[model samples]
Target chain A: MEEIKEQTGHMPRIGEPAPAFEAVTTHGTLKLEDFKGSWLILFSHPADFTPVCTTEFIAFTEIHPKLQKRGVELLGLSVDSVSSHIAWVRNVEEKMGVKIPFPIIADLNKEVSLAYGMIHPGQSKTETVRCVFIIDPNQKIRTILYYPLTTGRNMDEILRIIDALQTTDKHGVATPANWRPGDEVVVPPPNTQEMAEERLKQGYKCVDWYLCKKKL
Target chain B: MACISPDGKPTESGTKMLRALQAGLKSPEEIAKETGLPLFRVRSGLRELTQAGLADQKEDKYKLSEKGTKLIK
Candidate 1:
């Protein structure tokens, strides 16, 4: 397919290195390495001055503090020029009563969008669709989220997911359904018969012998 | 335990959503038609995907989250 042909480069994958980027941001020229030693949430919107994008941008800006406390940095991108990003950021601050302290890439060339697979043909040809990538401090891709044009994302869910991912990575466990920070985690099923027998003796909450539960 | 298909497809509802997504039915109506799931189920299933941040909802369409995209691929 022509679409497939257009995406020939080796795209970034979870557990793989996130492609490095150096571009002019709202403040000045910035590089991906500048965010070293912290988690990065790289997301994209279609364009500026749009209603839906504005609401999402405002929400992300508001949640930046919470994201920062957990060692996450926020970077937003769109196919808009530097001037456009500045204007929109100013407007968002003035009209929405929030400041976007993060660097928004002025990706007019569509380089970052393409590398991140943010552009989808069905969504819009010229503008990037909603895409969110959670890149870890080691520069490995941790998680990715793609959204349609109509619905808005829940910021709390994003926060919770990062919390879950951080905890899962730390403890080698899986968070259960409706998992919140400080809640019990779902223990991984014992992989062997011997281990299964010993696991039940631990007195973890279990729906069955192999299904153990413990708080994170 | 739900087993993945020999062809690497996910379990029943997972496979249904995958098939629908591949067919470009990221909307409720399209998913129902392709998977024979009720509209409510399709919506709720998609909601589950979104709630866990596995799906992104924007404007009026649905698409797999970047993480969901990788999982399906």
Candidate 2:
């Protein structure tokens, strides 16, 4: 355990493999490797029954089907017990009329939170700040988002980023600022002069030598 | 269909715009401001949302159709 702490003290970086873990959640026991073939959105909330977290939970539930259609899975975590998680899920369903379909980790020991670097001491010593890690099918961390305790997360942005990442991976291209699906994508800038010249006449909308956009 | 685009695919901006509309953001500019999406993307997303029958535009503002409200509920 000491060795694990030392290794995971630093936050995981994008493009690095997500740290593996096994934990008991509201659904059942799950391992990080269990989601190997699907993209995963591992998010952490400060606590259950909180107003901001509850709203975020509803938003996540609303968008869960869309995420599943794109081969993505959602997992939630907080430094709470399994009983607390179960009760909160029940309460959310009863009051909000939306079922939280994903498993939420009961990180009572803070093991998984530590592994994912979810807890920031400066933010709050007892609870975790809002943290989101977008892991691809290969278990590589693609994007990270952090929100303060007072704010709620934007589920649309989360879904949008998943689309952007998948689009980039599938097309070998980058997306411009605020890019959406069915929109023109950015072509990788050429490294050499010859490549730059060749790119201009490739039937793309080229604004300059290095910048180009083409319909996917 | 609430979040999916008319082309039969899911789009991030489309979802953002839909959520913004559900939150009472009426115009493309307001949607863009609320969601922090680019103006051009917001316009395209609005177009896609309209084509998908989830939203309707008045003189200059947009509102969720009954189908869209049902989807959110």
Candidate whose TM-score is highest: 2
User: Candidate 2 residues A1-216, lDDT tens each?
Assistant: 655445335588899999999777775556787677679999999999899999999999999989978989899999999889989999999998988888899988888888788877767777888999999999999999989998899988999999999999999999999888988999999999999999988988999988899999
lDDT of 2 by residue, B1-73 (tens): 2236457644665666777888663887788679875343455456656777888988878998887777656
lDDT, candidates in the order shown:
0.77, 0.83
Candidate 1 regions exceeding 4 Å error are: A7-11, B1-73
Cand. 1 TM to true fold? 0.71
* TM-score of every prediction relative to native: 0.71, 0.72
lDDT of 1 by residue, A8-96 (tens): 32356788789988766664455676566578899988898899988998899889889867978888899899889989989888987
Model 2 residue A33 CA deviation (Å) reads 0.4
Chain B alone vs. reference chain B, TM-score for every model: 0.71, 0.79
CAPRI accuracy category, model 2: incorrect
Give the lDDT of residue A28 in candidate 1. Answer: 48
